[model samples]
Target chain A: MRVALFASCLVDLFRPNAGFATVSLLENAGCIVDVPPEQTCCGQPAYNNGDKDNARDIAKQVINEFSDYEYIIVPSSSCAGMMIKHYPQLFEDNAEWYKKATDFSAHCYDLVTFLHDILKITSVPVTYQGNITYHDSCSSLRETRVKDKTRHLLACNEKINLLELGNPEACCGFGGTFCVKYPEISESMVNDKIADIEATGADTVVSGDMGCLLNIAGRLKRLNKPIKVFHIAEVLAGMTGIAAIGDADDTKKSEPSS
Target chain B: MKSKSHAFKQQAADALVNVSLQKALLNAKDGFIVKRKKAMDELPEFERLRTKAIEIKEHTLSHLDQYLEYFEQQVIKSGGTVHWASTTTQAQQIIVELCKQANARTVTKGKSMVGEEAAINDALEAAGFEAIETDLGEYIIQLANEPPSHIIAPAIHKSKQEIADLFKDHHKKYNFNSKLETIPEIVNEAREVLREKFINADVGITGANFLVAETGSTLIVTNEGNGDLTATLPKTHIVISSIEKVVPTLEDTSVLLRLLARSATGQEITSYTTFFNGPKRNSDIDGPENFHVVLLDNGRSNMLQNENHEMLKCIHCGACLNHCPVYSAIGGHAYGWVYPGPMGSVLTPIMQGLDEAKDLPFASTFCGRCEEVCPLSIPLPKLLRQHRNHIHHDKLNTSRSRLGLALWAFVASRPALYRPLSNSFIRALGWLGKKSGRFSWLPFASAWTQSKDLPAPAAQSFMSAWTQQQAKKKSSENE
Candidate 1:
């Protein structure tokens, strides 16, 4: 199968390893992956902020680039959500673009859901130690209904201990531009999320969206918590050799050997 | 009721640090959420009922004018006066004139979000009439000179201790000096003080949960029997409600009542579900002598013509507020208006001007939980986004962010510059933060790094790596 990896703008800049891990996971599942060079963004930030003109332009660009692939897999849920759920909304008035947007949305998928449901990959060939808790990103959980897919995949990995955190469905408040617009509210929400994560005593926090991972990991780092954060793709590909998000390499190398 | 939505950032910041308000909010949050969940769990047909409720509201709203006309005819047939107010000030003026004609010295009120929206108490007081709140929550906030925070639980932001203090401070005028430390004591004090007001008030005003056209009755759902007393014990009973509250039939009202209590306070039904049809008949012994219904449009008609017509489907259950994460985090006071939470965030900007309450639409994270929990299934996030669209298209947002979005959009739409530009920026960010793996501070991003570290970008952008991979693959294929 020819799969075009929609490495979202965040993954393109902040965390390319997630994109690479996604590719590794897809290839291991016996699927050919294509990273389309012309891809930019899914136009979520603009679409959400009500900039329909730019959002539609960005959508046209994305639709032009990825329409050739059999599947367009996004690494983050929010970006995938924007493509699958909102692109059609962007072109609700125009007939020609509306059909194109709807047709393209059906071919889009979040990375984890694509691997678990579409590819029928039950387990990853990689493993890591210590307790891991998952933060359900709001877009994936509500928009895409990506609840059991992550847990189902994680449950199959014998080497990883999956612990569920309290209120896992609660948002971590990394709402694209929301975090910056209302930092205090975002801070309060992430603090509550960190407390929930701390209560579980999970040594590592795993999430599907880099925006959420960055928000949670940043808070954890700020509070000086020992918990590490990683994308599910990174852990699934056993790419734990690199330092966890928001942590120095020395913190990983000179660990307390738990 | 004056809009302070623009100061939402400051108000939310204060609400987060308010220990007392946070404690009060935390204590009440679980009761509403958990009980609603349990009630829905017990009833197998909750989701189906929600669908029916949505249908009822939509059908009623689509034919709202016809139903409202029918409702007015029924009210006049039942010997009740129907007054139409196109604006909130008109509603207030009509009510004040009615009170003046009745020679009302003291007015008793049941908890009414509509009354709050009209600023009725202030208007009545300024007109030289004593307006007393009969509902316990309304009474507490009235004594404190505050607006109702939550629609159902008016004083949900007040702690028990705060209530005790408020009662001690305000109930002294009634010559009731008892230690009110517990919830029951505080409630008892309020009831004791309000009992006389209910009996002696010449005018009683209440808000309608649903206005039934078939029976020409206004339905109010309350835990306490304050609404019944406020309506029955006065010589003149005035019901102030928005035009959207009208329903086609009593059966439709019943369908809504089933979901209203369950959604608002998690009850199978409220303690009192009374329907006041009209003034007392000749044979009636103890009831109000005159009945008046003031239907306030107050921007609702404008909503009907806009993209936000669906918001008129709200039943004012407060379910959205309880289930909303943003509402739970900041509580209702931060919204700084008569209505707060998800519903308020959508309605305030529309009711008030888009420019007046500009920040309200942006206050949410668009979690969609409000829509999920709404009994009417009102697409709240969609309405909020509509407001955001208005704000954006009208250029109501800051020019800096507008320029930033413009620049970002320009770069994103062009891959040639975007690829190389983002690649170099990411490499620079990575190099700068290689030691800490995060940036404690960065230019133009202080708002982000103020409370949380900004994660550094990866050393290699995906596009560059993909380009290198393609080059290597082509070379290998050539060989």
Candidate 2:
């Protein structure tokens, strides 16, 4: 199966390891993974900011670029949600584009859902040792319905112990531009999320979306907490040996296993 | 009500550091969510009921004119009067005139968001009628001289101590001055004070939860039975309600009732679900001598004809508000309007003008929990986005933010331009913060850096690395 990876803009710029892990996971599942160079963003920023024209243009670009692939997978549920749920609505008035958007959306899936539901991959060969908690990105939990698929995949690794956050479903408040627009409210929400993370006493917190990971990791760093944050793809791909998000480059250096 | 929504940012900031308000919010948030979940879990047909309720509301809203007319005709047949008000001022004038006609010196009110929207208490007070709130929560906030932070639970933002203080400060004149220590004590004191007002009041007013057109009856659901007293005790009963509250029949109302209490307070039903038809006929036993329904339009007609027609379907159960993270963080007062939370964010801008409530729509993280938990299946996030689109079109958003979005959209839409631009930007940041892997402060991102550190970019963009890796693989396969 030829799958085009929509390495969401956050994963593209902030943390490529997640993108690499997604590629590795997909490749290991016996799929031919194609990184579509034309993909820049899933247009969530523009869409969420209410810039419909730009969002529509960006959506068209994404639909045109990845339409040929058998499947289009995004590591972040937010971006996948943009494609699977929102893209059709973006082109609702234009029948031609609407048909194209819906058809394209049909084949699009978030990485975990793609792995768990479509590929029927019960487990990966990678293993990690840690008491970790999972944060449910709002888009993952509500948009793409990625509640148990992630946990099911994580349970495959006997070495990993998953402790649940008190309220895993609450948003971490990255909200694309909302953090910048309403920093005070965003700070309060993320603080609540961090308190929940801390209550579990998990040394590591993992999530599927990089936007949320970055937000949670950034706050944890600012507070100078010892908790580490990693994208679910990195943990599942056994790439946790690299420095965790928001950590110093040399902090978690480990011998390369490959 | 005069809008303080334009100052939403400042109000939200104030709400954040308000120790008492924060305590109140923390205590209130989880209970509603948990109770509603439990109630939903207990009912196997809740989802089916929600869908039926949506259909009923949608049908009624589509034919709102007919149902409202039918309701008015039925009320007139039952010897009652109906008044139409296009705006809040008009609604206030109509109510005040009714009070004057009834020779009302004192007025009692049941909990009504529509009443709040019209500022009816303020209007009544200005007109020399001593307006008293009968609902326990409303009475608490009335004494404190504040607008309700939550629709159903008017004093949800007030801690018990705050309520005790408000009562102590105001209740001394009623000969009940001891600081109320327990919940029952507070309720009993409020009931004692309000009992006198409810009996002495010449006119009683309540807001309708739903207007049954088939019977021309206005319905109110309350736990305290304040609505019943506010409707039946006084000689004249006035119902201030929005036009969208009308449903085709009592059967339709029943479908919505099932969802309402469960969604609002997670009860199978409110303690009192009273329906008031019209004035007391000679055959009637105990009821108001005169009945009047004031149908307030207040921008709802415009809403019915526009993109916001779906909002009129809201039963005001406040399930969206309960589930909203932003509402949980800042509380309703910060939204600076009568209605608050996801529903308020959408309604405030439309009713008060986008310029006044511009920030309300943008306040959400679009977590989608509001829409997820909404009983009527109101797509609250989508409605908020529509408001955002209107703001963006009207250039209501700050020019700096607008420019930022425009710049981002420009580069993000074109991959060829975006790839190198992002590559260089990330590489520069990566090199600058190579040692720390994060930035404690950045020049333009003060909003984010103020509260949290910004994580550094990866050394190479994913596309850049992927291209190189693909080329290496191609060369290796060929060799």
Candidate 3:
């Protein structure tokens, strides 16, 4: 299978390891993974900001870049959701683009659902020894319905103990541009999320989306907490030897032995 | 009813720092979410019922004029008067006139958002008639002289201590001077105070959950049973509702009622779900002497013809508010309107001019949870996005953000330009923050750095590194 990876703009800039990990996992699943260099963003920021003309143009660009692939996979649920659920809506009035958009959306999947539901990979040959909790990004939990599929994969690793957050379904308030636009309320929300993560006593927290991971990890570091954050793809691909998100580069220097 | 929606940003900031309000919101958050889940989980037909309710509302709204006329005719047949008001001022005038004609001195009101929208209490008080709130939450906020912080739980922002203080201060006039300590004590005091007002009141006012066009009956579902008392105990009963509340039949109303309680409070049915057909009939023993239905348009007629027609399907259950993370964080008062949360964000802009409530639409994260939990599936986020589109088109949003988006979009749509531009910026930031892996503050990102540290970018962009890797792979293959 030929898979085009839409390593979201956040993953591309803020955390490249997650994108590389996603590529490794897809290759291991007997899929030829291609990272289309022309891709920049999924246009969520423009779309959610209500810049429809720009959003529409960006959507057309994204469609043109990845439409030829058998499957288009995104590591972040919100970006994938924008493509699969909202892209078609953006082109609804234009008959030709609407048809192309819908066809493009049908082939899109967020990474975890692609792996669990499509690839049917029950477990990965990876081991991580830690008490870890999961944060469900609002898009992942509600939009793509990515709950048990992620846990089902994570649970297959006997070395991983998944201690769930008190409210796993709650958003971490890294809502694309929401964190900056409404900084105070966003602070209170992410503070509540941090408290929930702390209550679990998990040394590490993992999530599928980079926006949430960045938000949670940034707050954790600011407060001088010892908790580590990783994208699920990084952990599942057995790439944990690299430094965790928002951690000093020297924190972990060894390579994965397996 | 006077919009503080314009001050939503400042109000939201203030709400965040309010210690007691935060506690109140935290305590109230999990109950609604958990209960609604359990209720839906137990009922296998809940999803099906939601679809049916939506269908019913769509049908009714499509023929709203015909159904409303039919409803009016049925009310006249039942010996009731139907008054139509196109604006809030007109609605207030109509209600005040009815009170004057009835020689009303004091009026008892059930929990009514329409009454809030019309500012009926202030209008009545200005007209020299005392209006008493009979619902416990409504009564508490009334005593505190504050707008309801929540629609269903009007005093949800108030802690028990605050309610006790209010009761202690206000109930002194009734010769009940003891400070209420327990939940029962607080509830019992409200019941006791309202009981006297219900009997002595010359006029009663309530909002309808649904208006059945076939029967001309007004339906109100309340856990407190106060709506029943407010609609029946007085000599005159006046139902304050919007035109969109009308449905074709009792069966359609029943479909909505099933979804309402479960979504609003997680009850299979409210403690009281009463229907009022009209005034007392000749064969009836006891009921209101006069019945009047004050159906207000209040921008809903415009809504019916526009993109916001789906919002009129809302039963005022407030399920969306209960599940909203923003509402949970700041509570409803921060939204600064009669309605709050996702629904209010959509409605306030349309009802109270777009410029007045511009920030309300942008206040949300567009998290999509509100639409997920809405029994009617109102697509709240889409409606909010529509408001943003309007704001953008009308240039109502801040020029700085608009310029920022335009600049970003220009580059983002051009991948060839965006790739290298983003690559260099990421590398520069990555080099700067290599030690800490984060920044406490940045030059242009103060809003983000204000509350939390901003995570630093990786040393190289993923696409840049991927290109390097691909070149290496191709060279090795050639070798």
lDDT per model, in order?
Answer: 0.88, 0.91, 0.90
Candidate 2: residue B370 lDDT (0-100): 89
Model 1 regions more than 4 Å off: A251-258
My TM-score estimates for the predictions, one after another, are 0.97, 0.98, 0.98
Candidate 1, position B399, lDDT: 98
Against the native complex, each candidate's DockQ, computed on alpha carbons, is 0.67, 0.80, 0.74
Question: Over the stretch A122-172, how does candidate 3's per-residue lDDT look in tens digits?
Answer: 778665778999998889887898898889989878788999888877788
Q: Residue-wise lDDT of candidate 2 within B1-479, one digit each (tens)? A: 68899999999999999999999999999999999998999999998998899889888888889999999999999999999999999999999999999999999999999999999998998889999999998988888889999998989988888888888888888888686899999888888888899889899999999999999999999999998998999999999999999999989999999999999999999998999989998988889999999999999999999989989889999889898899999999999989999999999998888999999999999999988888888888999999998888889888998889899888888788998999999889988877898999999889999999998877778788778877988999999
Return whichever of 1 and 3 wins on lDDT.
Answer: 3
Candidate 3 — which pairs collide? none
**B120-160: candidate 1 lDDT, tens digit per residue:** 99899999999999888889888898888899999888888
In model 2, where do residues sit more than 4 Å from their true spots?
Answer: A251-258
When summed lDDT is taken over every stretch of 10 residues in candidate 3 chain B, the lowest stretch is B450-459
DockQ of 1: 0.67
Q: How far in Å is the alpha carbon of A26 misplaced in model 3?
A: 0.9
Candidate 3 - CAPRI tier?
medium
Q: Candidate 3 — what's its lDDT?
A: 0.90
Q: Rank the candidates by DockQ, best first.
A: 2, 3, 1
List clashing residue pairs in candidate 1: none
Per-residue lDDT, model 3, residue A134, is 92
